[model samples]
Target: MPNAVEPPSASPTRLEEAYALLADASGAPWRPLAGGTDLMVQMTGGIGEPPERVLDIWAVNELRGIGVDADAIVIGALTTYTELRRSPVVAEFVPALVEAAATIGAAQIQNRGTLGGNVVNASPAGDTLPVLLALGAEMVLGSAHGERTVHADDFWPSYRTTARRDDELLVRVRIPLALGRQVRFRKIGTRRAQAISKVVMAIAWHSSADDGPWADVRLALGSVAATTVRARTTEAAIEGKRPTRQTADAAVEALTAELEPIDDVRSTADYRRLVAGRVLHRLIRDEGGW
Candidate 1:
């Protein structure tokens, strides 16, 4: 009997081989498969039409680890949440990413879900999206032609859509380093774990002191609109300001104007807005010590 732990039958083991398979018209269209945490679920639930052919990239050794460059931490696309949560590089350089990874589904899902898959899935409520936005991460896409980079903010152009072409594969994610940066992450879900997030927020800022002037502020929130969006207006409103009730209020008001949340089964529009404001206020107060 075939070992149940092995990947699907007839999967390619090399990246170039997989790309070549995808380029072949004989298969018509081929979808790359890594962890299959999301795709398999969708296929099983009949959520969408299944692909004609699959290029299983699970055995592609090239896209399966985390490393560091001169000024950035690079994570392979197929690096699972479980791998990220335990990686020393992630823990030292991007703890927010680690925190985000830890909250995604449960242990099984974490072990089976790839970081690249999460980004490509393009769910507005994806736990790591907001963190990536705040950290100013970039996606490295590869194909038979060459490689291209896309900023996190620009990758998702619409609801459940991305700029990635069918022939391109997201090979890795790159996050630049920022010292003395404080990161805060929150996910409001029906349950603590194993539930899709209703609202996810990530805030990163550099401050010389706990309650002093701040700089390089970046705030991103998910499950609010068509995609995970940065609260630029709100960030500008409180940037460089000393922690205070007035700044908190201004931040909340600015966020209220920026977000365009909709009512869904998980949450109401009004509730989401109100909770977002509260969360922002709390984040500023707690982190800023106001």
Candidate 2:
């Protein structure tokens, strides 16, 4: 809000020529910029020490498209939260994405903030992260050389750090055809909407027989660990078991054991663990663990 970075050198075309120049340049330490939804605000608030040489990527047409690919629904890095929330393809293909998109920030923030920024920011409390993790999404990184894909599950190496190399720009998030096996996204914030999540969970899977098993169960949780994590143990416990009361209870137990939540300002470890159990119960018992 305070600082609208006056480009150290003006970009003639604002978007196209900037990337073209940066693309052709050698070892440019330019900060590729976007909608300025997150980055600008951070810089203004003194969270960012100073502005680096800026390379604007926000206005690139190639980085703003969202559609279904051969095997996945691809959301471009520059695609805003509001864009995703209103996208029919995303709604049909990855409904959980819509759910997460709707809760990102206020309308203004959602209008400017992008999916790529969210992924790269790597906040544990990030609303969409758990959903992306559960859906087994992949990120496509682009640069002068080419592109590479990394799975969301294994993307983050530490708190706020990802496998994304510095020079590479995140191009798009790819959600595979296996996404909709069964999906439910849940968030626990101070209020219904517009509040940062205390806990966010996304659980996806397929139910077996009438009361038999649940297979391909994937559970991703946020705001409880250094980074978002998969509830593997809980998922395995109920994957091939009957979806009865007993199995549901055991699933909660497994989930609790798998997490290592720390005390934070919004919630405590005990509270988060308890909420995790309850969320598992609701997801598995009532909604058929999808």
Best by TM-score: 1
RMSD of each: 3.6, 3.0
Candidate 2 pairs with clashing backbones = none
On residues 30-111, what C-alpha lDDT tens digit does candidate 1 reach at each position? 7777899987777666666565566778888889889999889999999999999999999988888898999999999999
Q: Give me candidate 1's TM-score against the actual structure.
A: 0.94
Clashing residue pairs in candidate 1 are none
Error at 95, model 1, angstroms? 0.7
Q: Model 1 misses residue 283 by how many Å?
A: 0.7
- Candidate 2 has a TM-score of 0.89
